[model samples]
Target: MWPNPTIPLRIKLSGTPREIGLEHGRQLACQIRKQIEIYNTMFKETSKLDWPTVRDIANEYRVTIERLTPDIYAEIAGIANGAELDILDIVALNCRSEIALGLFSDGCSSLGWKFKDRTLLAQNWDWTASIKDNLVIMSISQQDKPAIHMVTEAGIIGKIGFNSSSVGTCLNAIRARPTDPKKLPVHVALRVCLNSTSAALAIAQLEALGSLASAQHILIADSEGPVGLELSPMGDVYLKPNDHGMICHTNHFIQNRFVDEPPWLSGSPIRLDRMRRLASALVADGETVTREALRKKIFSDTFNAPQSICCQEDPLRPLPTRSSTLFCIVMRFAPSTRPTAQIVWGKPGSGEGDVIIMP
Candidate 1:
């Protein structure tokens, strides 16, 4: 029998942070373990760090995380208990960005476009295909916080997601470093942003914590509009949409040139330019850009093969290092209705995948 292409596991949880997390842990235990093994090997191969060293680094952030965001910390503790894994292990998974310090060649393309009536945020999550099965879509509800629906690695709590408040976020990993243990880990920061009621509030929360632990580009959007926040330990820069009301970002820092962006993905520039041109073509003459238009014109483009906007694995590379577009998510946010995410399990334009909508 053939395996299903739409492989992401979906689950819903409500109540206290711990309860929500415990359900996440217990239900996705198999995928969580697989995620650990994948990350363990990836850490050693990409950053020359062993699992023990990674856990040690993750341990350093525990106190700071607990003090800064106790609710998320409690959730992490619950996930640990439910998964029957050490809290340090779960912490390491959540803090993978800080621990690795942008050492890996993870590439993604994100854009936020404002239509006349509604706004859209979309991205192609490109990374090693080894953990494809570890992805999950989580619908979480808490007492005071906005409800969240996000797609994340099984063991991670935060990632690309939108909340009940019409605020959505997309991430792009930058290959620049000097991570700070005192700050919130990248994933933790993502969760915090999803918990906020608005994009501005999310930015304020991250700024209050002194920015994220490492270098990253988080494209945050709400009913009003979108803002591209280039966060780093050195400083932070925000990129507003162009006059065309389009914001595009790949894996490099655009405004902050002081921070060195290694040549991890040489195709990044090519992909970025491609998106602008494609977007312009789609919206020329004030044409309204819709989700289907984006799906056909942008995310589906296979311009520079293997490294194009629609990334594909290079067979010449080893299985562990090869990367591809694991999933593509298109989110719609409007003032009058609830937020929703339309996700494709595989490459978007490939004509070979299934769509899953988030509630």
Candidate 2:
């Protein structure tokens, strides 16, 4: 289960309050509660959640859901309303495999490479999913505000919609040297992206929102490509590509530029090495580029277990105390006809969805 279930939702406004409305604000709050309840019911079945209870939880966390501009909220709420199914439930099904594999990350970055045979490789890694049962599903749209749907053993807290103007929908974990609860939660960045429609807009939103905490790297991918944006609270931002046809990000920073700054303290390089090794093995096999092959590689227990993805202290030397997988996410964005297949393995042996197209 997640060490903490209380995720505070902090909304920062960039424009005037006149742009927002009361009805839209109430609707956004209602939708957030609905999505959270859907998650709690699906995963935390024993505990039934009511709208009031959900609001109470949000209030307890000091989450100001109303800070989002009304226009943005209306756009996002419209998408949530249009969804044929409960967005949270759909995400739960989409990530069933990772849930089964017990792979979770603080953040994740993936590259959707278009190869010669109309094939694509959706390579990704968990930054903090290793932390136990922290499962989060995030989405960002261009016109609407961004939202995050998070699920842990405790239950669900952040419930955002899917779709972004520029970056599409993405989620990542930002590694902080000294963990601080006061800083804006990483989910806020996700919300910003969800609210953005285009990459240019997303970038603008990031600049305006500013940083509440010191973050190491961000896991972002969309129809365009995947990017690992590393940042410091001081306003330094670095961009890296998932050039390896396949890229898996962990909590530790992986750029050579940042190597000189406390490599030992930032993140575990050894874990990165293991992921690289696995990627190499898969690429060598040639079949790793396929979505199915990538999934097999990601869920392989031969290299490690408990934490499906390894978290090592040192790549050169080995040490225990490493973290394991909490939830695994395999995102495949092929032609619309080719269903976006996601296999969630919440447990060992069997899983709950179809290999061809996630539930």
Question: What TM-scores do the predictions have?
Answer: 0.97, 0.53
* Candidate 2 residue lDDT tens string, 1-359: 22232221222222222222222233234444444444444333322444344334333212222243234334333333434333333223222222211222233333344343332323233322222323333221122343222222212222222241223333444433432222333444554554555445666666665543345454454445545556544454545444454445555555524322433323334345666676677767776366556556644332433333422222342221233333344544333323233434332123422332221
Top-lDDT structure, candidate number: 1
* Global Cα lDDT for candidate 1: 0.89
After superposition, the stretches of candidate 1 with alpha carbons farther than 4 Å from their true spots are 1-3, 285-287
Q: How close to the true structure is residue 247 of candidate 2, measured as C-alpha lDDT?
A: 48
Best by TM-score: 1
Candidate 1 at residue 304, lDDT? 95
* Alpha-carbon RMSD, candidate 1: 1.5
Per-residue lDDT of 102 in model 1: 81
- Report, for all candidates in order, the number of backbone clashes: 0, 53
Q: After superposition, how far is residue 170 of candidate 2 from its true place, in Å?
A: 4.9
